[model samples]
Target chain A: MPNSETMAGTSAAHSEAMIGLYDVHKSFGPLEVLKGISFEVPRGGVVALIGPSGSGKSTILRCVNLLETPNAGTIKVGAQTLAFSKRHRLPGDRRLADFRARTGMVFQSFNLFPHKSVIENVMAGPLIVKRMARDEARAIAERLLARVGLAEKAEAAPARLSGGQRQRVAIARAMAMEPDVMLFDEPTSALDPELVAEVLAVIRGLADDNMTMLLATHEMAFARDVADRVVFMRDGVVVEDGPARQVIETPQHPATQAFLAHFHRR
Target chain B: MSGVSYHWDFSFLWGYRTVLLTGLAYTMAYTVGTILLGLVIGLVAGLMRMSRNPFIRGPAFAYIEIFRCTPLLVQIVWFYYAFPILIGIEMSATTAAVLVLSLYTGSFYAEIFRGGILSLELGQWDAARAVGMRQGQLMRHIILPQAVRRMMPPFINQSVIQLKNTSLVSTIAVTDLLYQGMLITAATYRPLEVYTLIAAIYFVVLFPLTALGQYVENRLRYAE
Candidate 1:
């Protein structure tokens, strides 16, 4: 077991947590959002962050990439660790860019570069940030598009795609970056009810591949089925963290129960 | 004919062909030069206007505000007359016209650039940053492509307006189309015919440009 631990450490994102957030605090002027929140996602772990609206779930997801710099906290992603003090400046531009390259994010609205074709959106990160060769980047993009079942849409614009298709393309775009960890901020929340299944299926496939992921989502049933662990947060604090099945079936906190009740009404 | 002239003469224009042609070319050259230089200034000013640093943003704000509030005609006259006097360095009429028009057009374009950028949803910025794109890459790849599409129609409209405004340079005796036309009218003592010909030339030039503007607008139209 000791030998295995060292072996795992050598492999990229093997046993150690790929992401860690400790005592993270965030505020927007007069309003406070995340208050001393802490969590960890082990290599290949799928952690689902479920919470009510304005519960700081999305804010937490944003902080992982420094899109919304935390008011205070320590964050670690992959092998890089960032510590924040009361007056800590944001990481230097070069450092932040490097941190971002290691992490991929999908958004609720897809945010696919609307002007670019489907293949271009997926290839953009590798081509621009990674400075990948055109042919090499194109091949990677083609592979990812095929994986998402959007190979035919490679030449299509994001505006022409349906909601489900757009989100799938967004997923493919993120995956093309070969990030060590992926973040989904309500990836399916913006999709229509009938269209939600397609996006969920892509995410499920990602889970099966053992890709480390942190998702802020409202798909309770999917979370129960796919997540290794569930983190229930409300009012900027974790209410319960446990196995997905246990948390969904038998939540310990009243707030979690109340929140779950709203979802279960359907 | 409708107002006073019972007869219109086309013979006068034949003698002044070279003067008119030269003026037209000068007008076009000045317009193109102003557009290129103005766009550069606008892009830099627009980014500065959005900067978080007050030092950069303040001067940019002042430039946009001052130029926008004053009339283009007044700015041209002031630059032509006062700039050299104040700086103690003389500039030709053509040089002053180009400088004034470039700055004036740039002020309008700064607003166009700023608005196009601000109109993008915050989600796009967040998504781009999440992918770890640097500020420059984000703008070149994500922000500008989308923003430029929105900018094109207005930009075309501005181009048309600026082209017409190029005639203002004639007032400073730059020997542009309108100025040449004025000289022809004074010499011929046939103001009606000369002015009518000038109007026709402007219409002929501007009509095609307006059509091209519309074509660009339709081509770049984004799907909802």
Candidate 2:
């Protein structure tokens, strides 16, 4: 019950939500990406959202940051509800840039700026978004890179790093933003099986530090191992949500059990 | 006699070396200036063509299409002569050359820049967005820098073309290198020797640029 209480408390914090979505809908011509997607993430907790491919998990994550405009919805991040629609006429809002300043994301493909060294990539957020002094950002970037065990590779271009190392650098880039919460969009899904362990380890370290996180991933084992709560999604709706152990072990919903059965085998 | 005599005097080019040298400087200055301006306009226009809003998107696409369909020489002349006639504004031959050259090169540069940025793995855009970046941030931070590595060759190539197009400015009396060469040929009786010297100077200037382009292509490929 305390777990549900925690979730409710997390949801209640939506009065000035760190991130919130309500009745969001998105369509690309005839292809619908989000169908009334609604959820909220509070200040500090790890919420793992699992769903089938094309279930709009990534879209939902993107909409939170206004990367993808939803056709109809209200998204609030930290007392500010972003306006997103197919036809709204506001352009070049620098405040939106500032809002994203306090939020960061680790991507599935480790989108490190290929031209920049690992440290430069890490420094990009603070330098560009936060307007931190270059030298200061560089110093802190090295520390963040070190935190992810990439200190030696600070001067290395991301192309020179291995898949896992690049993803860790991507994580460091996000962390350097000093965000309130970090969003991860399948951060390890692109890695080789062996490399996944290293990425998962860096992520585990972030969890250990009690950083608030929202991850959309299919790594059920990872969900069970690190996630505080698991949300099973189907057809763009949350089907079942509970503690990782219970949800993965004795899923009540038919969809959840079926999903776990497939997940357990592999 | 034509083969043996060569009907050429080299003295004219040597005497007018100052004219040729000044023309060369203007050529390079014109090329470098337009290439940078063209690249900036192309970068913005290319992204605008991809914009989400139709109002923002349509004009960029239309502008690029119209310019791309028109010949550079015609555009140059149009800007040089017709522009003043149509718009009641007069620009000098040099100014007109630079303005038309930038617009002409910008349309082609837009294609190269857009293609380079687009060639990036689709996941790059997704990754940028997931970090809470707007399209501008995504372009400036993620896409532009990465695209640049692939873009250097074509961008440099456009500059080279801009350099070559400087010859076209001679028609408008801009006194570019090619025009100066022609002027020397007219004043001097030795067409063979004067034209040969001009060709050598042009080769001297262009060969290094072409080599640099090749070097850049190799470096970017190796980085990948």
Candidate 3:
């Protein structure tokens, strides 16, 4: 019934959806992580994946950008599509790289290039991957840094920045790629409580600006406030999929209700 | 107990300074040449060692192990005296010295390069790949720049050892600083002064290099 409902939802917004994952299956050795995962993010739509730690939320986000190739499924982002199955060979590195270029991903740990300065980290994708002119890259980097409210720290090293500042810079770095979609894998999980707001504010700003994003987060309150749709995952499968408010407030599935209960109890 | 007191003099060495200088120049030349060649070999071999294919990885592993386990002195001698017989080709002492030293230094450098790269967190690679950079670009732009800072102290330390290892070439009559000292001892009958000056010259050259390594290490540490 969920699959049919997903199909019905897909066709209703097929023209707008920027990301699609169908029957995605993933495994690590003998341990299966994602079993028949399916979801779609319409353009400018914010979809938050919520679940406990081992619930395959992060795996789903990673698969969206081909960071962890699925054992079986089809993943589509923008104009690129990757189909993975036993019979079909995986795409070559060049093709995969080009496909990945279309999407941006922010990690739990802000994996900024510590060796590069803040602006350089922002400019890295455009300068090295896109082969943009130095002046052009600098201008883009400066603009993105300003947008993220870290323009003053452009010349500073990543080590010099606070956790929140680094995460903001990471957002700017990913934004510089001009990705069709952005994937945030617990972007604020590594930050202190005080630091989490600044990063969440930046992400909220992105959502306000209509950036299509798939966020895997434990921040239930933020997810309800910012995400347009919520996909509740448990044990590698989506147990409930509905509007952000409905799923968080009145989850239909017992699994989802139990998961949200822990968050509300806190 | 009665003991014979030997006269100590270094003034004699001042006259033969040019010979010692030329010998010093040769030592430096070999060191620079072999180090460059060894670095190239190390890079290639290090990369090969990381390759998923056992065919590529196996040879690199064998090469690193062979040179690392055996003595550098024996390698130099075997290349100079015994290798030519096996290959059936005439080999010069200079050629043999350079080849053996480069291979020896390369084996160690390969490990340093590989270890430095491997020490980086997997997240760094993920970040680079996420931005759509290929393997080569990630290694060149993102990985190497950081890894090189970690690699500096060990790299310089290895190069310092390579410089000292050059002394082994003297056994094959290569006119390095040590060989020059031996020749000077023969003619002047001043083994003490001649050998002592040779050791002093090596100290002078190497002390600065070691100091430079520490300076770079401290700078990189503060940079982070």
Best model number under DockQ? 3
What TM-score does prediction 2 earn? 0.87
Query: Of the candidates shown, which would achieve the greatest lDDT relative to the real structure?
Result: 3
lDDT of 3 by residue, A1-266 (tens): 44445454775333557999988999999999998988899899999999989999999998999889899988989877778998878787888788888899999999999989999999999999999999999999999999999999999989999999999999999999999999999999999999999999999999999999999999999999999999988788877888999999998888888888998999
Q: What class would a CAPRI assessor give candidate 1's docking?
A: medium
Clashing pairs in 2: B8-B190, B9-B190
Per-model TM-score on C-alpha atoms: 0.93, 0.87, 0.95
Q: In order, what is each prediction's RMSD in angstroms?
A: 4.6, 3.7, 2.0
Clashing pairs in 3: none
Q: Identify the superior model by DockQ, candidate 2 or candidate 3.
A: 3
The TM-score measured for candidate 1 stands at 0.93
Which tens-of-lDDT digit does each residue in A129-159 have in candidate 2?
Answer: 6778999999899888888898999888787
Error of 3 at A67 (Å): 1.4
List, residue by residue over A130-215, the lDDT tens digit for candidate 1.
99999999999999999999999999988889999999999988898899999999999998999999999999999899899999
lDDT of 3 by residue, B95-205 (tens): 999999999999999999999999999999999999999889999999988888899999999999999999999999999989999999999898988888899999999
Model 3 - which docking category? medium
Q: Residue B87 of candidate 2: its Cα lDDT?
A: 87
